[model samples]
Target: MPKDQVLGPDAIAARLADLPGWREADGWIIRTYRTHSWKGTLMVINAVGHLAEAAWHHPDLTASYAWVEVRLTTHSAKGLTEKDFALAKKIEDVVGWQPGLEGGALEGTPSDPRFAYIKHDR
Candidate 1:
C-alpha cells in the first residue's frame, strides 16, 4: 500500500492492541528487545531481517551489546500505515520476547541490573 494512503491512529491502535510489546511514538509504532549479549542481539536482528525482507518493508534498527531497537515507519507513505503496524506485530511475535510489566523495566531500570548497561539507539 502507498504510504500516502496510510492508516490513521485509530486504525493503527486497533491493530496494535493485537500486537504485544509495541508502543506508539510520533505516529509510528516501536518495539525494543533486550538480549543477553551481542550474539543474542544479532540473533534478534537476523530474525527481523528475514521478516523485513519477506514483507518488503524495512524498519529503522539500532543495536548495542545487549539491546536492539526497532522503529517502523513508512517513509514512502510519510507516516504510519497498516503495513508498518503489521511488520511491528510480526516482529514482536517472532522475537519471542516482551517488554517488562513496568514501563522501561525490561529495557533496563535501576531495579533490574541485568540489562542496566545496555544502551539503545533512539
Candidate 2:
C-alpha cells in the first residue's frame, strides 16, 4: 500500500480493535500513555519519537510530567491514513504495551527506575 493512503472507517475500526487504548478523534488516532513519574513520561515520549523517526511517520505528541498524548494523522493525506495506524502499533510495542491492559501497572518497571517507585502492599 502507498504510504499516505487514507483509510476508511471499516479498515480503521479493524485496526483499532487490536490497538487497545488508541481511539479515533478529531481525524486522528489518539492514545494517552500514563506514567508513574515525570521521568517515565519523558521516557515514553522519547521512545515514541524514536519510533516515529524510524518509521518516517511522525505524530503530534503532547507531553506532561505524568503522561503523553499521541495524535497521529497523515498531514499529506489531510485525513486518517495507514501511516497513522501503522505507527500507533509500533508505539504500542515500544511502550511495552499489553492490549486490553490499563495504566495501573508499571509498564517498564525495573529497567526504568521511574516506574519502580511503587510498592505493592501484598
Clashes of each: 1, 0
How well is each residue in 10-69 modelled by candidate 1, as lDDT tens digits?
888888888767888897788888777787788889999999999999998998888898
* Model 1 misplaced stretches (Cα beyond 4 Å): 1-4, 97-122
Q: Residue-wise lDDT of candidate 2 within 7-68, one digit each (tens)?
A: 88898899899888889987999998877778778778889989999988889999777778
Candidate 2 residue 70 Cα shift, in angstroms, is 0.6
Q: Residue pairs in steric clash, candidate 1?
A: 3-77
Candidate with top TM-score is: 2
TM value for model 2? 0.79
For model 2 the local lDDT of residue 31 reads 90
The CA lDDT of each predicted structure is: 0.77, 0.79
Please give the TM-score that candidate 1 achieves against the real structure: 0.72
Q: Per-prediction TM-score, please?
A: 0.72, 0.79
